[model samples]
Target: EPVEVVVERALAAQAVGIDGVIASGQEAGPIRAATGAGFSIVCPGIRPGGPVGDDQKRTVGVAQAFADGADAIVVGRPIRLASDPQAAARAIQAEIAQALAAR
Candidate 1:
């Protein structure tokens, strides 16, 4: 769906008792327009800034995700496929902290 249309979906979901949306691509910008109204945004396919290895090209870095108004993020492939899963997890955690601090 077009980014703008996702906002409509978010609104519709809220109308039906849903509480959030999994924003991606440029949808975050539009989603933020609904900010004061209240709702959560969880961005998936979040990676550490590199060539997106999987089909979910709709990806964003940790900082950018937060900057774009993601309430939370789902880190998958990156940590699971990392040479050191523990370090990758920690790195992502640190990135999240930095992003939150910046906010």
Candidate 2:
């Protein structure tokens, strides 16, 4: 979706008393600004330097998602399809920690 439309919808959702939104990381920043700091934004389609294929088009790294004002992120394929799920999860956790520390 176009970012302007996504932000518009997020603003509208907030206006009607919606508490949170699921947006792409790229759109989270504008949504945050429109909805204020306390509003929750859960971003999906997170990719950490892996092949994205064609399933998820609007994806970002964990660090970028947090940097773009994502309150939470939903990660799928990377951990799900990893040869070592535990290690994949740990790597993502480490990325999250580094991002938070940078903030």
Candidate 3:
């Protein structure tokens, strides 16, 4: 969906008392602004500098997601399909740590 549509839906969801919304990283900032700091924005379609393939279209790196005001990020294919799942998870963790530290 377009980022504007996602933001609109998020705002509507918040208005109706929903605690959280799932949206692309691009919409997190606007949604957060409209809904305030307490509203949870969980971003999916995260792709950490790799092949995007076909499933997801609006993907962002971990750091960018956080910068965009995502309260949490959901990653799937990168960790699940990696040859070494543990290492992939660790790498993502490191990135998240670095991003948090930078903030």
lDDT of each: 0.80, 0.86, 0.83
Model 1: CA > 4 A from native: 35-37, 50-54
Which segments of candidate 2 are over 4 A away from where they belong? 50-54
**TM-scores for candidates 1 onward, in order:** 0.87, 0.91, 0.88
Better of 2 and 3 by TM-score: 2
Cα lDDT tens digits, model 3, 1-103, are: 5767877888888889999998888787888888888899998988776336766777888888887788899988899999999999999988888777876
**Which has the greatest lDDT?**
2
Q: Could you arrange the candidates by lDDT from highest to lowest?
A: 2, 3, 1
Better of 1 and 3 by TM-score: 3
TM-score of 1: 0.87
Shift of residue 55 alpha carbon in model 1, Å: 2.5
Worst 10 residues of 1 by lDDT: 28-37
**lDDT per residue as tens, model 1, 1-103:** 5776788888888779888888783577678776533788888888876336578777878888888788888898899999999999999999999989998
- Give the per-residue lDDT of model 2 (tens digit) for 17-101: 9899998888888888788887899998898753367577788889888887888999888989999999999999999898888
Top TM-score hit: 2
